[model samples]
Target: MDEVSPEETPSQKVPPWLFRAILTGAVALGGLYVLGWLIAELKMLIVIVLVSFFLSFALEPAVNRMERLGIRRGVGTGIMFLALLAAVGLFLWAIGTVLADQIGDFADDAPGYINDIEDWLEDTFDIEVDAQGLLDEFQEGGAVANLATRLADNLINLGATVLQVLFQILTIALFTFYLVAEGPKLRRNICSLLPAERQRQVLSIWNLAIDKTGGYIYSRLILAVISFLAHWLVFWLVGAPFPVPMAMWVGLISQFVPVIGTYIAGALPVIIGLLDQPSTGLAMLIAIVVYQQVENYLLQPKVTAHTMEIHVTVAFGSVIVGSLLLGAVGAVLALPAAATIQAFLASYLERHEVVQELEDAEAAQHPEREPLGDRLRQMLDRVFTPK
Candidate 1:
């Protein structure tokens, strides 16, 4: 007659097996937590290893071709790294010399440009703008002063970022060199540690990744060259300074770097174009915009679909996810990673029609409870029906 507590009920008893199970689960969860913490600590190293792997995949085709041409693998690796270093050095040198000069020239020429803009505005729109006055107001309002104060802060932040990036690049270069030079031996060593079936599977996956990564890089290189030529023509015609280097910068960055690279690549050329004339700058901007639109909406999708055999939508999504996980390097690596994953899954997952996972839950919640007579009637109808 007394109210029974659920905890005291016979079915509610904690058996020795259940207790052991709970303890085991708790210990497992704790171990997982520790593992997660350790991984977080090693995240930078993990990113470098992954990026290095991706780069090695991308460059392996060139190394193989060099070998086929009678070059030793070590020499081929050296040649690849040397080329990479030359490009990086050029980029750095251009940034230091050209960019620094441009900034100073910009500061000197800004007032003249402002006057020309004001004169044009007055002539065209009857808007007698005081651009110089506006700039003076901004200066007086502590805006320029604020910029001066923050310049040091920005420089410090930038230096730290550059060092971090250089470190990552160095790690990737070292790993890529080793992978290119000793790939066959490395594969043999790795395979020796695994069983025969696992070794075969690992090699298969590795080969697939290399193929996709090589294809991705090749496609990008082709596009980059086209972009470079197109921009070079534009820059030469417009009389922008350093047309060759500027075009190379735009082409490589816009083609290879993800998301915001287009704007960064286009900015210098556009600014230099403006130094030639406002119309030239506007033309440059328009051309860059149109080209980017074509690349994003047409060229990129077609190339990726053909080369990596990945849908544009999947490639775009993977880039977003990868960028969120590991910033720019992740975005660059994501497409090939997605392709590799698709290839790997295709080897294992069954081909079947899919159903929603929640369907069983819904069916359980809304069970069809029928009367015994109704069930009998249904059974009788089924029995009487033709097979």
Candidate 2:
């Protein structure tokens, strides 16, 4: 081969340090990409673990109370678990029994109800309709019938679903038990990992997380109970069928989902009412709307103010984003997730020297100006200024 000229020898390549830096960056990027994929793939498991941990945290106060009252830690945990199981079992049994009875009653009266509905439709719209044909189409060989058949055919698949749920529950319980048992030790260990100067800050964040989460759980429980009782009373007064079961479902579902819970809870009763009488359905709808408004404006604000202090817009956005990302579990977790983010941001802003300096400067500049625009400018200035 011909000898390469000095100018064409590629300058003996770049330095090793620069090459190593490039390699390191590429490796880091690849690792991050892989980590992202893993996180997405394992999202469900991550959610389950997080939910279990938070629930355990919420239950710790009760366990501690029991321990203080002379109960052994294991026994207290067992008792708490038993109490939870019993409550859940009883609730499910009650709902199932009520649903079965209602469904049977609906079946028995369906023909008359269909006839009434058809007649009402004809009278209201002056259009004749084939009620029997519709009912028959839904009975055993129509669209609805096909769907039912498909669901029945897939009953075997339900076994897998059940197993998955069971596995998740067991995992959660195991994790929760350990969390409750070793909560103090875990906290101590976590704190011990921090430098002496940073430990206080870390401890403060931990305490804030615990307090906010615990308060949120307790307040939500109380609110759910109140909502259930309120709705139960309304249904009882209105003479709606299966008021107790419906109310209980409203409570439980609402506890899981925040703003939208009332609407969902109202839907069942309204549907049932429509199958009974149009006037009944209308009344149920009105009651639901009124109750939801009251709860949103009055009850929710009072209960949540002391807990998370998240804005309504933040709450709604969080729910929508979370549901889009991870479905029902995410929706249920949206508030806590938002609250946690808020806590972190709040803490960071408070502790950041630049932020503090800007805040001080703004406070010094505007001692009494409360005009909306002035306040907005001041806030922007504080947010953007350097230390």
Best candidate, TM-score: 2
Model 1 lDDT tens row, 255-287: 778666788889878887777677888888887
Error of 2 at 327 (Å): 2.3
lDDT tens digits, residue span 240-328, model 2: 77788877877777676666776677777788766666777788788778877887799878888877689879989999998887787
Evaluated at residue 45, the lDDT of candidate 2 is 85
TM-score of each: 0.75, 0.79
Whole-model lDDT, candidate 1?
0.83
Score residue 22 of candidate 2 by CA lDDT: 93
What is the alpha-carbon RMSD of candidate 2 to the true structure? 9.4
What are the C-alpha RMSDs, in order, of all predicted structures?
Answer: 14.3, 9.4
Clashing pairs in 2: none
